[model samples]
Target chain A: MLTTPIPDAAETRSNATFDAILWALSRPGLPRNLPEPGEAALIEALLDRECAAYAGDPLLIPVLAQSGARLVDLSEADHVFFGRLLDAEYLRACRVGSDLYPDDGATLVIRARIGQGATVRLTGPGVNGVVELQLDGLPAGFWQERARLIRYPMGFDLLFLDGDRLIGLPRSTKVEVL
Target chain B: MTLASLTKPWAPMSYGFLDASAKRELRRKMVKAVCVPGCQMPYASREVPMARGWGTGGLQVSLTLINPQTCVKVIDQGADDSVNAASIRRFLSRVSGAPVTLDTLQADLIQSRHRIPEEILREDQVLVLQVPNPEPLRSVQPNMSIARQMHGDADYGRMWLQLYEQIVRSGRVMQGASYPSMVNGRHVMTPSPIPRWDVPKLHMAKHLTILSAGREKRIFAVPPYCRVEPLVFDDVPYRVEDHAGLTCSRSGAKGFFMNEVPQDDGTSAFELSDSEYGVKSIRRAEGDPVDLGDTWYTNGELTK
Candidate 1:
């Protein structure tokens, strides 16, 4: 009989983090708990040498460097970490990829306050009929900018981080500000 | 950074049998796959212990998502005890400390080849399907680049034309498996050669499904509550296989998918494709206390 392999601390954390991420994305507008608070778990679970990441906060530069990912401009980055999105203009430069390769679109991670902001309605593939959420800490006209920039099958995916809780807004989801 | 800070202490093997980088890559790809339902995303297919064509793709996804707490269930063509399914199940248990179960309702993660479970999967459960060919446009357009362009433009004229030709030639849609289905009303994806009977189970399913092709180096997903409509003309409605009325010879289970076994007497004997379900039925008939979950198809009709 073979003995089962034990997962180390890092392994356990990454696995749990990914499970939360997958669950949150599969059910858009639904919040899920991460293993620990912050984007460190997300970086450890998702970033590597194959990624081109752009961090808005300078403090995350060393961490991104340690992941062996090249630091590129917002437009060129496949993964964009906007610690606290202060300007809606930055959304214009995020990569939406092309219709041929929608996967090339950037994954945007931003800090926000969940359940305490403007009420928005979500309707799409993952949603059952309609889902309502409250999100804050983003710049004004954020949803309008997002609506203007995104095209069907060609848009970036967003993850809102609030302490240890996270909510996903995939490209396929249609958000209506209420 | 110092060398010690850059690397950790070496171990006998990496957890889950995949390196950290490979797992990270797969994680990124999976995020993108779920973001855009039914869109095939290319990834770096890594090497595993199994052969490339035989469930390697599904194995990689399973390894990436698996942890010690995850209860895994693997199946091949709806049988849990087949050679391929048994080997994969044993391998998963050996590598990770995850418990293995034959019950569909008890599984947290299921890796299957060419068949979805008969039981209705809950929203928490995930289904990883092994896809030999990810492209639904491969038959109509052999060239991959043109196919990509066609998918980008939502140009599926050739696909409809192919179905039309098949109907004219055979007087019925001859596509037995891997029936082309439109997902999210935008992209047409081949649901991995699962029998026509199994395709309807994916429509608005509560479970999340990830279809990966290792040899083809592609990964796609179908999020919960997503649309998956099979291609068919309005006049000629979509039809499933005619195995609804067939009864299993040994277990007496009926109204589910079955496998036809040829006999020397020139007749065919039918057996339940889902071996575990068959076993449960036989045990229940024997007066054993058995708990069977509600299935996706009730009386050979899709209930949910």
Candidate 2:
């Protein structure tokens, strides 16, 4: 006979956080609820010593430091946390990885208001059909910048955070302003 | 920062059988795999309680994804009661306190070896397949570096040539399993070693599939609503095993994949490959309450 192990608080939290992230990514443009509010739960679930992180927001520096991730510039980082964008320069500077190894592309985490701003239509893999979404609080021409910088099989993935809600837009997704 | 902030309390074991860092790394790779939709992603194949080749890759992914609330189902060669399936299910339950089920409809996470369940997987569900080999170009190109270059270039002429040679040699395609497929019209991937009959179930499927090879240290994914087309010439169409119209000897279930059992009389008896489906059929025939979800195939034919 064997006894079942009970999950601790940290384990439960990370699990929930990952579930939220996975669900959000699997169904792009759909807002999924995170385990707890803000990016702390995400950092706890995803970051570790093996990661090279870059935080555009100074407030996230301590949290990234606590995860034992080596903080570096946007080009060298595998994960980039840009709290809020007033310019689209970060998208241009982000690593798109190479054609040989597309997995090396950086995962960009940005803060934006969901269901509030410019209406965009998303279509590609992981989407059942065309999904319409409204996202605000980014610099002008952000979508164009992203579209211009990303190349198929060699582009970064984006996760938009708004309080406890988040949405994922992979580079393969075609974003059209409608 | 103090050292105490970086460290946490010690425990006998990690939450889901894997440590936090391993899970994190898997999570990162999974994200990339899903984004690319069938492109192989490299990862550190961490040690688990099981052997490297015996569904350990699938086990690791299941462990990283499992939670107390997740209802897991494990199957080996389409049967849930096999030794491999039973052991992996028990181990998963013992480690994470997640409920184990033999029913495909009730399972939230399905870890399978060599076979996909007969029932249709919903969008909310995930299927993790154990991959013996992740590279589809291995047969054509022996050198891995050149193979990687081929994949990067989307040059699948050699794959077509291999199929062509098989057709020229044999009357039909000799590939019984691990058929090469084009996913999302971008990358060619081997959807594990599933039989030709099961490969059609992955085309524009609603569920997400993650195929990992532990020994090979590679992982790939097929996201929901992605196209997975098996390569075949226009003149020679891809064909599945002729198992349709054959009824299960015991359960009377017809038009599903079957396992041929040899008898002493030199005759073969057929049994339903999906054991749970057979059990459900038996129960339904015995006037017991049972729910059978929609399957991928209908009367031995794929609807889509």
Candidate 3:
């Protein structure tokens, strides 16, 4: 994990969320273009930051070498799934949807080699028809799994990358792999 | 400005899509808002791959107005504790690195939903309200050409008549949130979803007001000293709404705009007031950023 003084709290805040959304819609399967190269430091910082709309407190950060946030009190909560996803859940079953709140399920963040390849046919609001992006050897059930969450704006918010290229597909999108 | 060179940081944001150019684009819209004095210009809005029901428009406004020097306050359902309010507060704090607070008074800009703050705002303050649907004639008629004509000529006789019809048909206005208004006697527009209760506050507000919608992809504004009046008949004037005796548990204020928070047993609680920078001002020692509270937030209500 990298370390530096939290800049001045004032420096990091910006209004680019809409811009990001526009980028996702316009580009279709292409990853939202980063105006600059994605630095390892920036992603790490975002992971540590938990949006207030989500349930958490001054959520603590754990730097067990896999640096990110963790819910402190999850005994009565769904700690197992989050722990499995982030901390140590094995990459066994390509679990697409959870049992409870199946409609509003979790997004699987795979830190793997994903590509805007030709295996998948993607079309939805942002695309002018079918746009294509490919990933080799992901959790086998990834796309079939996401199909479980495709009702509307009630599913996972996906962020994928191979090494440099990154993309986000919110539930409003339709992902069809041909 | 090749990426290989130009190492000065903060020049380009590494995460999310909005570049400084994007923020600059929004700044252009804001200038028109200032120059025309209460015109709701429709601008192209980008969807930030979030829930459509979310506050994308407010997010855009805050992004444009915020800078290294600005402090921000965000509220949802008229309370700082509301879920969406907290999320946006943390969001803006992340993007701007400008310190954010639950205290309404300390902010240079305040982003709100459902209600304006119980505290007053100043001329310098910019209040960005999130709008879901902007077209006042959306339900009245679907013709874009017709709606544009209606706004261009300020020919709201049809809108006025619809309310009149409501009074004639049912003894009430027949509409609730997403109420319509006339901006500076020109733009007949919808003032987002801030219950009819908060509509009057926009009239001649000292600070500039901006509105945005991410789902509908629109942005609008009300300039300082601009007029924002609701539809009403001469004999039956528009009346202010009261929240069945609503009050803020923290501030002890009553009948401000409020929201219902679902309690554990499926009952609900009332939140009638936006956060007050008043308490935070007292909490912090007289020196730090908290001192910014002394000037605004208590610019107090715009009472006749």
**Candidate 2 CAPRI grade:** medium
Give every collision pair in model 2: none
lDDT of 1 by residue, B1-304 (tens): 8888789887877888888999999999999999988889999999999899999999999999999989999999999999999999999888888999999989999999999988889999999999999999999999999999999999999999999999999999999999999999998999998999999999989999999999999999999999999999999999999988999998998899999999999999999998889999999999999988898788888787
**Model 3 interface RMSD over true interface Cα atoms:** 16.7
Off by over 4 Å in 3: A1-178, B1-17, B47-49, B244-251, B259-271, B275-302
Candidate 2 wrong stretches, greater than 4 Å: none
In model 1, the runs with Cα more than 4 Å from the true position are: A1-3
Model 3 CAPRI rating? incorrect
Chain A TM-scores, one per candidate? 0.97, 0.97, 0.53
Between candidates 1 and 3, the lDDT winner: 1
Worst 10 residues of 1 chain B by lDDT: B295-304
lDDT of 1 at A164: 99
In candidate 1, how many clashes are counted? 1
Q: What TM-score against the true fold does each predicted structure earn? A: 0.98, 0.98, 0.55
Instruction: Sort the predicted structures by lDDT, highest score first.
Output: 1, 2, 3
In model 1, the clashing pairs are: B178-B193
Q: Output the number of the lDDT-best candidate.
A: 1
